[model samples]
Target: MKLGTLVKPLLITGLIIAGPAMAAPSAQQVLAASPVDDIVERYPAMMSEGIREGLKRSPQLPPMVADTIGYVVSNSFRAADIEQQIVKNLERDLSGKQLEAVEGWYKTPVARKISAVEIAASDPAAWQQMQAKAAELGKKYKGTDRARMFERFDRAARATESAVDTTIAVQLGLATAMAAFSPDSANYDELKRKIENQRNAIRGVVEQQVYDSYLHTYEKISMQEMGLYIDFLESGPGSAFSKTVTQSIQQAITDPIESIGNQMARFLAPQK
Candidate 1:
């Protein structure tokens, strides 16, 4: 439903599809074809100022300390290693052909164009621009058509769901990290309860972001190019590729949160 992974800073960020197999892609081939690299490289977008923002919530924390967290998030977040990890993870489930197909689609002029848009969207300028366009697109799809456009993207890369999953994963990650980071500051159980309680609200937030992000990413892409991407998403291999990558990203996000919990437990443990 969402990436809903608790990633590290402990905060961050799955999918589905299936079919009979041709030869699956080799690890190298999959890596060569898939957009995992680009996604990894662009990951800073998912993280900008978040670690610091979360730290700001702590009244006892000093600004310098908060800045340290921000530095780790913005400067030292190891997205490339995580990307390598994701490539390995997705390769476990996806076939060569499937991976190749996904790579092929992304390699097309339209998909490359979309890639450029996505890279830009990860930054403040592009997001601002996309936000404006999403508003316009929202207007264009108003009333009964508003509901229809939500349905409109089911086949088009399932862009909406993918966006929601990524956003949720990040939130879950941040909440998880916050709980561990402040284990002694509040009742951990109560904090986790609050996180669970807000899941739906968070989902609503992610949904809107997805809607805006899709419009934002596709702003420069021609309708014809957009249509091709949609067709690829609907295809058997493409669908699997999307699912595998989404799942891989979720797992990548999930691992750091788990590590934070374990690490925190040790950090708080009595020194025997």
Candidate 2:
């Protein structure tokens, strides 16, 4: 999906993961309080540069994006703890696919992709093209308040894409860390399978939590959007069209998350 489309949904998802307070501290505070400081302290040479780079990039982000980065950093630290749990509980080393899966989680692929898009969006020509396309879509769906709906959809799509990327990064990162620290001496394939199993289990839980949080946030946003749409419809000339477009946008916003939950459930199912 287009990057603009995913922004809102991704932001909504990030907000959900961040919880009600959503009170992530500034980059400075995060640097001080982050558990990764332990890792950095231990492997100063290996990690300090990367941490600094991440921090440098952190300030370039929009406030919402910066908060999401904090969430990612916090989650990465938590993944380390979970890795220790896996080592203790499973009594086996992580390998291959399993390793990849865990490492995927913290890598922030979604954010990276959005970063690229934001760059593209910055170019005047590219920005104009996007607006032109949006206008065309608006015209095509005329009389249905399609213009505003199109904008929301474009934003939501970008957000969803980013969220999915972030999800993958977190999974992969967790898997990699688990493998590095695991004590068992199983072969790569066996280790990998076990790691994948564990990763899948952990991801299933994370996905469910994220999904629930997203639904709650979506409900609130949808209600506000609907209320505003109704007000426009009542006072303005586009009431019926506005309602139809709003409903359609809500469905588009929800369908992907629902599908993602279903897909995750399949992976999470009990192995008989």
Candidate 3:
């Protein structure tokens, strides 16, 4: 037939064929679409509050020692530093389609609502409220379908897993700080093993804490909203994004602590 008609068809076919080769969302674009950066930005302050509470519980902990640990944690778990590392890891791990899908989901209305709740819950005051009302909330949700659904959501979101990783990271930071004052510093492996040996115990605590926190955080979010969020998390791209972010966060926090023992030791050392 006509030359113009033939060229139009060819152009359409070429575009269709090239669609899959289009550039994926950049790491910053994906992060910007998600709540990850916001959540990470609050980490240092949250950690400081956690340490303060923990120190309160540890009446035996010397003030100087507590101060040292605080200093180390504050310096070591910088939000910008962690976010930069997470971007690097996500860049390496996420596929173009996966990143695009994750960005799409995070941009949704439901995700925005849930993300707001999560960000608010990340606050120290929110944590304190959750802790204070944990027992009451646990009883209210117990034996209900809501609780069951929450379990599924938690599993999909890797909530407990991430919490455990955070617990381990905090412990590792403390150990690294303590090592600074010790005569013989434990190597990374030894410190890791020592921390990991308590993983089961740590998981038990984090599991309950995560559950309670979820209940409190999502209390305002309707069941339908939570269900939609869960569906996203269970999807292939969602699962991958959840897993990648969790691992990236763990690495960002731990990588510095792994070698921080030496630096902290030197910093805490007496002037020569």
Candidate 4:
């Protein structure tokens, strides 16, 4: 699948979008707050990076070709459009308290540290050290506990589910785009029907890739730290924040994924 083309219409949803006005702060004020702005600034770059990585995995595609296509499509992806969608959602659903909670937690030292690690999780330099540490730590815990810890870490980082879902969405987009753009002589419905048969297989493959990436990303983060992060995600404010962002993102992508998945064989990203 051409990932760049797939994510071209991805409307990024997040926790720090514009929310209601209350005693805590106005929607505009929340937008101006720290960490909120920080995250907002990062999404465009992240979106571009994510698409680039996805394109790099296309079977037999030349690096330059993939890079060029990814770059062009990502460049055309308007951050403003995404923000507007987020704003619309936030305005309708999030309460002032929820907004403040997101802001407050992100302001915390622990949250800052976690976010920094996450932001750098894809970096080569950081991965070298993190992976080495993860190897050491993996041996420290054995059996059931280690397995349990792995699940905790993966969920906290949203590694497995998000990746799998995103890939599913992208692949569906590819199938849809292919059908939509095909010539009059082409059988779009026939192509869609063929894709439908492969959807489950693509999902299964994507799930495996997600698990591998999760294991790698969490390699440096200690089990104890993972526990704490898990706690934060399950906490009142933390849970609210995580759920709000996750739900919004899920909502934004779910339609496209279902639309495409219902028609095309999923475009499976090459496992890293």
Candidate 5:
């Protein structure tokens, strides 16, 4: 079957996975329950409008891109579970009002603003303009640590973007595998094996890329921030970390991203 033929079922699988569960559902069951029309209807007005415009303007962007973009817009718009976990993690260090303020941004009309930005970013002219602006900023701030920091930030941003793309590929492969497992299919077992193999391959690629790229950048930025804090503590009346404790704490925080990367690999890796 064509890739577009799988889009509806994949979306249904997403809804089931994202929804509340009495009992765990398999990928196939989730695909069977998905309502494609309902999924399309749930998209935000701005997204629908933008998708229409994109197809008109590009005319060559594959139908799959439109479908994938629609799915992304829909999922991101309603990713409450992911957002809630992010908020819960942040709340450990933030006050109640601060948490509320952060959550409030998600409810605003910001998605439309972001959609516009994405549209602009996709345009060749606009992308060139952005690169030119970046060069201008680099020249203006040359010779300062701030410029160095900006360069690091740019690198981190690119790494994060790569991480996101890898993640999407992993998710799509998993979804496709799940969609292929139907009881009526005579070659169900063979199809399942193919799916599992693909899932494993994609998961491995994503996990390694995330570790080598984003995780390393994260460690650098984090160490830079911690250095400022350490300098303050050393210069002031109080110091929280003795040299031994400082080394221990830095390792403690930095070690977990590696663990997280491993866990992601295990979670996405297909069962033998």
Candidate 6:
């Protein structure tokens, strides 16, 4: 899941034991202990909301076509499916030590506190609040040490990078949804190139948005607490977990997107 969710971004579950010893924690166990599960559960709605807004700002399509795109996207991006993918990837990609480290870290008081704030920030409602208080946040933390710390946290979390990846995914989904309508013009490779070209511009907007989100999300969190969280994220295990989740989400999101055009085409086809 992306934090600060689709407008922003998103855990773990279960264990087996034998005799007196706990079995090596499965990916499911790690996930149950992590924030990914809760945060990811909110993704379908966040993504739908984000894309709906994006579509509104885009060149106008007929209401029926727009609705079709929304429906296709909504169905294609399922939270359960994404969570399952993350769990599977975690089991396959992360070593036993890495998994144990992640699970342990997430169960920490500091990690829990940070996770709670992050989960809260993933709500679409939170995005609304962030916008409403944007000015207040900017005035209060614009140049302070806390603001700088938030910047460090953002980098540590790769929040801007995740947001950028999400933006590109959404754009690619849009192009895919419209491809059937203009296959000749909607060359996927060409569209991908165009999206790549806008990377720097996208980064500028996303970086500020991510920073603002950090300010808003961590408003109650102390600078010291933020510093500790940043340090963990920069640590080996924490970095591994962050990358794992990021890659998992990217794959889950992009995998479905590839075939969405065909789905949209079928959905928009005339009833026989």
lDDT of each: 0.60, 0.36, 0.81, 0.54, 0.37, 0.79
* lDDT digits (tens) for residues 1-272 of candidate 5: 99887998999998898765433332223212222112223323333344434443544445665465445443433323332332333333344443333233323354223323434443434434554455455455466565344334433223333334333433333333233232343233454365446655655664444333222222223445533423432431112112222223223222332333233234434556
**Which one wins on TM-score?**
6
| By lDDT: ranked, best first | 3, 6, 1, 4, 5, 2
lDDT for predicted candidate 5 compared with the true structure = 0.37
lDDT of 2 by residue, 1-272 (tens): 99978898999888898764444223222223222223323321222233333434533334453344334343333323332332332222322333233223213453233223433443334434554454444345455543344334434333343333344433333333233333552443454465456655655554443333233223223444543433433532232222322333333222233233233333333445
lDDT of 6 by residue, 89-165 (tens): 88888888888888888888988998899899998888889988988998988789987786677777888889899
Query: Could you give the candidate ranking by TM-score, starting with the highest?
Result: 6, 3, 1, 4, 5, 2
Candidate 1 per-residue lDDT over residues 1-272, each given as its tens digit: 24444433234211112332344556556655545566676565456465566667877556776566556555534677667666776677666666667767777777777666666666655656676677777776566433354455654455656555555544554454454445364444554566668767876776787776765566566666666766777788877766766666666655565444344344434445
Better of 1 and 4 by TM-score: 1
lDDT of candidate 5 at residue 103, scale 0 to 100: 31
lDDT: which candidate is best? 3
If scored against the real structure, what TM-score would every candidate get?
0.70, 0.22, 0.83, 0.59, 0.27, 0.84
Candidate 3 C-alpha lDDT tens digits along 210-263: 889888999999999999899989999889888888888887766776566556
Better of 1 and 3 by lDDT: 3
Q: Which run of 10 residues does model 1 get worst, by summed lDDT?
A: 12-21
Candidate 4's TM-score reads 0.59
- Candidate 1, superposed: residue stretches over 4 Å from native: 1-25, 57-62, 74-77, 132-137, 140-169, 172-190, 261-272
Whole-model lDDT, model 1: 0.60
Residue 222, model 5: lDDT of 43
Clashes (candidate 2): 40
Residue-pair clash count for candidate 5: 0
Evaluated at residue 156, the lDDT of candidate 3 is 97
